[model samples]
Target: MSARFAFNHATAKFWDQREAVEACARAGAGIGLWREPVQEMGVAATAKLVRDAGVAVTSLCRAGFFTDPTPAALEDNRRAIDEAAAVGAPVLVLVSGGIPDGGTIDSARDGVRQALAELAPYARERGVTLAIEPLHPMFASDRCVVTTLNEALDLAAPFAPEAVGVVVDTYHVWWDPQVWQGIARAGREGRIASFQFADWVTPLPAGVLTGRGQLGDGCVDFKRYLAEVDATGFTGPIEVELFNDALWARPGAEVFAETKAAFERVTA
Candidate 1:
């Protein structure tokens, strides 16, 4: 399956931004970036670095966390859109914020709806797609209210494709019984803004943030996912965004090499 593979820098969260870009450039691979490092390095400077290296910034790590819809949060997200445009990445992945204090999960989801309604136009103006990522259900209460591709698509359906979309991350939605159907529906709706790969493993670490297993290290049926997404005629970059602490503890270069190999092995 001729899928275009990209490495998400969160796999080595401590890696220097320049080193990650250079590694991706050397491997002829695309990269997914995070906001903290981009901000620390200066958005324009990082943009120049990626441009100089001739590497594709597949998508920016995140922008939306608007469970409260505070003016400050919206402003921050707007800044993220500009940064994404500056870096030449078409999509700004959104981790829909968790439940707000004194609020239910449903209320948090409603907040996401309001936040999207407010930000979609801004993103469209900047030529960036706000890609809502439905994190694993385990994180539903504290990390992301959007917990499945179906929910994400429903959230995105109200917007134009270029203005808003959804992310299909294997680690997050692999356990959903209707995942394949969700992928199909996402394709039919033209909202698959991001396709990410990460295996789900047991003994989720404290906070369950960096517990993603390496590709083929868990039960994800990557080949089936690839084939299903392919059937939708959605030809886009496939990114591996592992958040394993073990991988992060290793050298970024070594981790990058191992990740690329794992991606190739399972996707092949």
Candidate 2:
């Protein structure tokens, strides 16, 4: 089980990219990368760094704030797909942008559908899968409007599974009564592109952007989630992707070590 643990860069938002890669390499773990750090390091350089370190990049953090789907947004998503390919990451996790200006939630969802149609083929051609992530409903207004696995799957259904898929992040979907059924559906359709883990804690902080709880410090049932995902024949990295501000304030190496331990404990 430990062999499948992966560290997502955002968990240690302030860590140096090179150091993070080295740490993952030492632990014999995979990594989930974010676009900004990759861009700052130069995609080519980052690719070589991970390659040389013998670290596998499980997925790329994002590239889908296209509720408006402007020409620039589409182009940026295209670049993200390209970057994922360069870094040897098979999945590009996408968070559909919230409601656009003057648009209702329904309209925003339609925009997501349009954006995926335009970008799925591009992603496929680059050998990357666009994995749509549904945030918790509380975030439906500003961070992501697609707030359930079922909704995400509906958006992905039009495209080939190879081109589009969904992310099953524990923090966001653990409360959904229908999540199990949704996971089964995603698996049967061969659309489980990414499986991320983040615990859900109560009394969410102001804005709630970076309040993801550490693995065992909250309410998530990691073992059960593992069982369901494993039953799906999805044998991929289980990325630890917390967004806690407290973790960010600490030294990254310390957070990384602690997170790795917690992951092993919870998932063991």
Candidate 3:
């Protein structure tokens, strides 16, 4: 089964936001936006840009990190939800933050549970779905406490499917032995909110934040992912979100074209 494509703006982190939107618009593809760029352009203006260009905003990159759930953290997430609604984005992707200082992963995960309970109603009221993204275990210490789809699904279960769901990014979950089962479960639970792609590469970089490989450049078998997710009856846009530093350094238009081609070739 062939999947529709969406370009995640982070794939070209340095590209002008308008240019990225225009590129996606020209290609008749969907786009996933990050909050920083949207805020930098002003949410209303960014909304107008996409609306005018006739581009679809598949999901908003983030709105979680509640290891602290500070008043500020929740406030920021509220604002993110508002931004997502303003831009007509149905899903707000969340990376449950890492453990707080002096705290264990278990403790931090508790905070995420509490935060979700508090925010789910708010998000649902606004018709925005908060998609919990389980980052790879490599980032468990610093980036996200949610390191597995099973864990993400568990966290999202207490809430209604319309308010909370899980993000399936191949780069993050492909290594898990139970990923296929996890995908099946997400489907049965009606919680597969967003599906993203980025291949895994080796020789860990210093930060490990921007080392994502192109679609076919690494070990991710995207065909398998498409099959598994499609078998579950999910026909949403498959967003390609590479964080490779080399791709970010190149012209965004070229990167977009190349990434789209890679996505087509792998899913073909």
Candidate 4:
């Protein structure tokens, strides 16, 4: 089907910043970058480097932590939009942060709505899209409260196309019974801003958040994910974003090579 592919920087920390982008360029792949690493290299310099290396940036890692609903947090997201624009990335992934003190999930969701109200228009004006990424329900308590594609779409519906959307990460939504339906709806509504893949596993060690499995190393069906996303007419890059500690400890080149091969194998 000629699907495009990309890699997230977290999968290969063993390679220095430049080599990671260079490797992706060499592989003829696109990239999704985390804010910290990019900030370290200086956003302008990082943009120049990626451009010089001829790599397409699929999306910026994240922006929103709106569960707090504070002015400072909202302002930070605004700056994130600026950074995404500066780097020529079309989408800024937003992870709706966890519940605020004494607030319920319902209240936290309201925070997302409020934050989006303020930030979506700003993002639209800047020519950047905000992609609300539904984190795993496992993270519902601390990391992010939005834990399903359906929920993400519900949040996105109130905003314009250029202003708000959803990031469908397999690691987070694989267990969702309504995932296929959700993907169909996302496609029908034209709101699929990003597509990411990672595997699921048992015996989750400490820091479960960092234990994302490499493609094909766990129980997700990539063929199904690919088919569904393609069915939506969403032609964006499929990004591989693993957070495995084992992977981070390996040589970056080795992780990249293995991940690329695994991606090809499963999608093949």
lDDT: which candidate is best? Answer: 2
Candidate 4 lDDT, 188-262, residue by residue in tens:
989999999899987787879889988887889989999999988888898999988899989999999999898
Clashes of each: 0, 0, 0, 0
Whole-model lDDT for model 2 versus the true structure? 0.94
Ranking by lDDT: 2, 3, 1, 4
Off by over 4 Å in 4: 1-3
Residues 101-197 of candidate 3: C-alpha lDDT, one tens digit per residue: 9999889999899899989999999999999999989788788999989999999999999999999999999899999999999999999999999
Q: Model 2 Cα displacement at 223 (Å)?
A: 1.0
lDDT of 2 by residue, 11-67 (tens): 999999999999999999999999999999999999999999999999998999999
Clashing pairs in 1: none
Model 3 quality (TM-score): 0.98
- Which 10 consecutive residues of model 3 have the lowest summed lDDT? 201-210
Cα lDDT, all candidates? 0.91, 0.94, 0.93, 0.90
* Lowest lDDT block of 10, candidate 1: 201-210
Clashes of 3: 0
Candidate 1, residues 1-268, lDDT tens digits: the string is: 3239898999989999999999999888899999999999999999999999999999998887898899999999999999999999999999988888999988898899999999999999999999999988878888898998998999998899999999989899989999999999999889999999999876666747878899998889999999999899988999999988889899999999999999889987
How accurate locally is residue 265 in candidate 4, as Cα lDDT from 0 to 100? 88
C-alpha lDDT of candidate 1 relative to the true structure: 0.91
* TM-score, one value per model: 0.97, 0.99, 0.98, 0.97
